[model samples]
Target: MILLLLLLLPAPALSAPGRTRATIPGDVPVVVEANHLLRKGEGTLVASGAVLVTRGNDTLRAHQAWYDPRSGELRAEGGETEARVMARVDEGEGPLAIEAGQVTRLGSGRLRASGAVHLTRGQDTLQAHEAEYDPASGEVQAWGGESRARVTARLAGETPLTVEAGRVTRVAAGVVRAFEGVVVTSDEETLRAEQAEYDPQGGELTATGAVTLEAPQGRVQGERVVYNLRTRVIAGGEVAAAVPAPDPEADVTYHLRGQSIRGAWKGEPGSGLPQEIVLERGRFTTCESPRPHFSVDAREIVLRPGQRVVGKGVGVSLFGTRLLTLPRIAVDLSGEKDAPGLFPRLSLGQPDTVGLRSDWRGTLPLGGAASGYAVLSARHLFRIGAGIDRFGSVPFGLRAGYKEEASSRFVSGLTLTVLPAFTFYLPAAWSPDGPLQVGLERMPPSARLYSGDIEGERWAPGRRYRLIASGCAGRFSEHPTEVTANRLSFSGALEVRPFGVLPRVQVGGALRGRVGYYSTGTRYGVVSPELSLYWEPSRRDRLRLDWRHQIARGTTPFFFDRIDAERSLVLEWRNRTPRRALALKAELDADNGGLYAWEIGYSRRLECLQPGIVLSQRGGDFGIGFTLEIPGLSTGF
Candidate 1:
């Protein structure tokens, strides 16, 4: 509602063709101009042909206007063939303008505008079918739904705001209210509520009664929500939220129910993504079922959206049954598919090999690009040991530490990239059994003739070939014998995909050969040639088969590097959907003419959690294990 204080002072009427002016007595004189002004019946006046009324810095233009001196009533309208009536007022920062089909000032000091009414003040604007303003009460009300035109208001800034509803009212300066299916959109967030009010002075919008806010990052619903437009902060009560897939490439959505929640976003100024959020007395789950299979409850939870979530006084539940409780728990939003099994990581070991073994592993950052990892394991009953290794990479240089499980030897190696496709490594090992002895383990230089992504299933027509060759000379302390053994070895592999077309179904082959000579008067040479066929039936499915034959003459002194099978056939299949995946692999021994080893794995994804199982069999040994992992925080059980 706009207040137009029109106080007219009577002036001599004119019927000439030229323009005439009538003035109003005021601090800022009000002037009325018309091409023709005529005295109507009694004290009534009529102004026609380009009627213009100006008061101070404000001006109104219309085709015709009628005024009654006694009633102090005025009416203005656009001609049948002319544009709508328009008015503009300067308000310091910018101009305020209004346009309507017809406008009237009632005897009771009420202003009404009908038919395609539009009002704009500075960066804010409103549009409706009709509007009414009462100057005495400083209230303006707009209605639109009846004519199939909903009232819309726009508040523009860096993060622009637009609201549309059935009705809108301005009760005071900088305060606006809306009702009935009100929707407010600010940048990427869209909010809907039964009723809402906004205060431009404070940059606050309060929504009540079934409030819901949705954005690209997630969805939030509550009974009431107060959002700070400028700061992009949200505070709400009794909220339920669904954070779908941390990003667009994910398939999971985490559902959270909380008594109260507060969130703040950090990104592009108007991205509407909450990077930090706090929820009180809440429970969350990745399960989509109404009755969740698993959930975590916590007294307080803090979330760093798309990164991790931390909870205090946490309880984990499965099928409405409490499984465990802890003082605190934190999980990453990115989940891993395959990880070591539950607490005290257990692997089903063959009795003839290592029997049952349990291991605990941890990693620590050693600063810069270096990290240290440790593994403690207990095998059978007599063997218990811990091994630590530090690995780092600087540009093209590599540093690594490793442990030989069988002989309890610690090995450290440094590799330097001599060229883009060539590297040299020097390795040394120290034995901790009996008397400590350190010796040079090996020196290896490797070169890759060519490297390519031949299995990417894309049509890049060319003959793709990859070849890598390396040679090593080393002195190792062989167990059970005190004598030192000197060894020289060479290994190389050459793979070539001769055809570039038919990328979805490609054929490849590789020739791999190794030769070793020991000062202990033992020599071994082996060569393996393999033919592999790969097929990708669709984006979600892949199949590959490999037939390999090895020609062997002698055995190596090291048991760990000895070849167990000479001829084998391997087949692998992989299938994936948005939320589920399956993988299977099998190998057959051609010499024994029977199945050698096989494995099957399946997993389902839910947000940041992926729990899976693997079943495998080799020879007479069978094994099964469960795995859970979080990729973002890199933790698993």
Candidate 2:
């Protein structure tokens, strides 16, 4: 049977003495082990069990092996043997190894490892005390001690990816450079670097010197920092810094120092969306007074996500007083409230006898309601007078006034008279809700009279009630017998709010009648009755009381059957006190045949000083007067 099947087939494969076995070139059958054979020069190989090596798609395994075909050294050792090394340039499932002690093949496609160096790819795990590998540019370089170089990456559903560096460098393919204290964690941001560079094929992350960029919308301090995980951009450089959320009345403390700073993370996905800062050469100030009310300067500045600052060279001040100089300035973390305006004034005073007096007032904004108000005025009453010296014959007088209210419903009016004459007011219409009035007159036919009047008022349906009326007619052209005198006056009033729990209390009464017919017999008749009382407790207190009564009957020539009766009483008061303390005005008059008069006044305020008093008894000649007031020389309107 062919020599007994060649003695059971297995005894002719043993060559030991100057040992040699080498055949590693492809298709899975590789074995390289030698004892001493110096094939081309010198050699040493000692392989004990299971040592296999393949080339093209690289596979290497060993138990105990040593080979030196004259320094193309390959060494592997194992007490618990397990080594598998493979390479296919580097993608998934390539370039991996386990339990490597010493393997040296240095010829440009370098590879060198000292003691325990384990490297794996595809679920990546790299541990090294020392390793330097380059299988034709699929680089790996690591250093150890102080917690010996460790790298781990699991990726895909992400949780493992970690790196700690004391020193690590793989400069080219898929670049990485870390030194000193560098740490990179990957479950969405945790990086600290004294120097870090990682470019997993340009999915970029670069950091320099003292850089720190923590995530969760917060810290970024830098000398250099750049991160771009596929265009999710973040950049920083210089002494670039950022701090948001700390305002104690913020007088310049919303920080972002910059030579450069750029950040963006918009919309959807965990919605903490708060990074949209773009600043370069920017500055901001909130002004807590030692001379700053507002400040901002920018070549560029745009910060969103509620710290909302959009700026470009803007400056504003108040208290440190410099009102607005802006190129552009916008700040609204959305708490909107703004109030400004009212720093205009001019005045000079001496309010009675009207000598050396000047007044001008201003306040505006009626329709847009910033408290809805309007007022403007001009007054120069230097010597307003009335004089009469009976038998010795002399007469004198003067008056001037100009007032304007440009929009609490329009009024620009003027009144001027000299010697009981001249009067003028062409524009009229005043409104506390439309109470229209008009008047015109001209008289000089030796002081007779010619007149015109129109008035209106309507507030009947709960506008607190009002119905007042007036119609006057006059024509008296000097009658020395061509006799002319036609006068008519009609009036009505009923405006009552008698104290329905006193909303400033007001009581009113008025009835007036007048008629005259003369062709020389001088026929005339008059009846006047008036009573008024009003009290406003606040809005700067005011009180008033007035009573008037007059009855007249006439014929002509030193009285043929003429009788006259007059009675009057008037009292008024006004008050305002506290810083702008002004309580000015007093007038008391009583007449019926008793004749009494009293006048007291004060006007200067704002560091107040005032005194004024006057008492007069006309028929028997009695008088008293005193006046002195200085409110820092009063000037305001």
Candidate 3:
């Protein structure tokens, strides 16, 4: 039985230790053992029992190793300790070594390692849970369940730099490829990604798939990110980051989803270079308010500190609600909260005893350096109809002025105003007295007037002292007529405050002179002057005293020389409770002479109520009135 004999016969004698079984044309020997053979013609070799092969500096070892001479590849299989191999050909003092439990060489200088592959070249070391390495091209790939690898290199200063990854591969001398939950941390920052590549020679790193960068300035999140360490530049896609400001009040958090984001370092220590951020197509939202108070969407946007932003196809919203949409929008980065001022107000109300009234006022900017501005306002009142009688009137007017700011003073443009009025009054026999008629008759029936005025004030450059001067002239009509009576008025005031004073001391005087000539042959002249002194010892206490004298003379029996004089003193005190939950104020007024009058009132305010309450007594006409007001609902006349 020839087959039995072939199986039982001893294998051909393998080459002895340190012996050559086959030699190449250049004296390059191929070695094998008793159970191993190198068949160049058959393109295969088999080795067993701690097999060892050498070619110059290249060495291979394994319990069992195989080679295909036709393909010029080698493989080893056995316990990793025995499967280790070193490959080099007089390149240097040391050779590159590859060790794994099982190694397969697939020609083309490529080797795949499974079960704890480790690569080491001099002081450089790479350990992968598993890997594939090509010595000829310096390409290595490692991946497996929960795979990870670490690489370390000693720099010129003997400082060791290390990199760790879940999966790693070397593509070239300075480039390494990594994937599947990768993280790279260097001396300056840390980066995480689903995939990434690093090149130490180029000083560049790129990442994708949920990439995130963490640095001292901020944290950046994006889909893709690339960073250049040498230039200190970082570029990203669909990035979002948090930037904090130096001022606590000026700090703002922004959300930006854009085409890309880039940052560079200024080279100066601790100085983050000003960033130039471009959003090709993106939007921004702020985290401030009852809702997101501000938001803008644009086709393109650029951001730089202290620079205005101009956006196209812009949409802006406040409090989470769209407020405006524009083809273009620009915003100043350094503008004050209320710098560009425009205020308009409208109100309607009915005082318990005064009937119904409405008022409107608004301010407009005139656009100039002189602080030119205009004000337009109007008011209407409808007296409650009683006993089949109704009375109502409307008054409207406009005033424009220019203001200039000087060293320590402000001057106002001369202003002119005209107001026409209409009214109805029943004879004294109609109604002796009623709540509605008590204070209504004091209003003029009808009037037309014109006036010119100049007002100027100077506030001490660094102190609380002020001086004011004002004057005006106008005409009035008791009834509609082609010609109307005229009036002249003037006033002056001065305020002084000593150092460490809580309130200023104010002294002022006013003068009014009127000369009227009617087309109906009626003439009258009147002059009135008032002197006043006011002192506020503190925010809660005040005192005022005034004296007025009036002289009226008429040219006809229908009129007469009427002389009236009055002197009054007033005192007020206000205080807030220690708890700050309640406030109280009291006032006393006394007048003597032709218009002798005395009044005392007190008011208490509570935070929960509309405002507060007042109780007053004046001579024999004492009464109590309460008022509740909301900004847009109250009317004052």
How would you encode candidate 2's per-residue C-alpha lDDT over 371-429 as one tens digit per residue? 11111323432322211112111111112122110111011111222222222222222
Write candidate 1's Cα lDDT for 557-585 as tens digits.
Answer: 65433554788899999886665668899
- TM-score, each model? 0.62, 0.26, 0.44
TM-score of 3: 0.44
Residue 575 in candidate 3 has what lDDT? Answer: 41
Clashing pairs in 2: 34-45
RMSD in order of candidates:
11.2, 26.9, 19.4
* lDDT digits (tens) for residues 442-556 of candidate 3: 1111111112111212233343433333333334322112223443334333334333223477776555454544434655556655565666666545566655555566652
Q: Pick by TM-score: which candidate is best?
A: 1
Runs off by more than 4 Å, candidate 2: 1-30, 33-38, 44-72, 75-110, 113-120, 123-139, 142-194, 197-206, 210-221, 224-238, 241-255, 258-269, 272-304, 307-331, 334-409, 412-637
Q: Which residue window of length 10 is worst by lDDT in model 3?
A: 1-10
What lDDT, from 0 to 1, does candidate 1 have? 0.62
The local lDDT score (0 to 100) that residue 220 gets in candidate 2 is 69
lDDT of each: 0.62, 0.44, 0.45
Q: Which ten residues in a row have the lowest lDDT in candidate 1?
A: 445-454
Per-candidate count of clashing residue pairs (backbone under 3 Å): 1, 1, 2
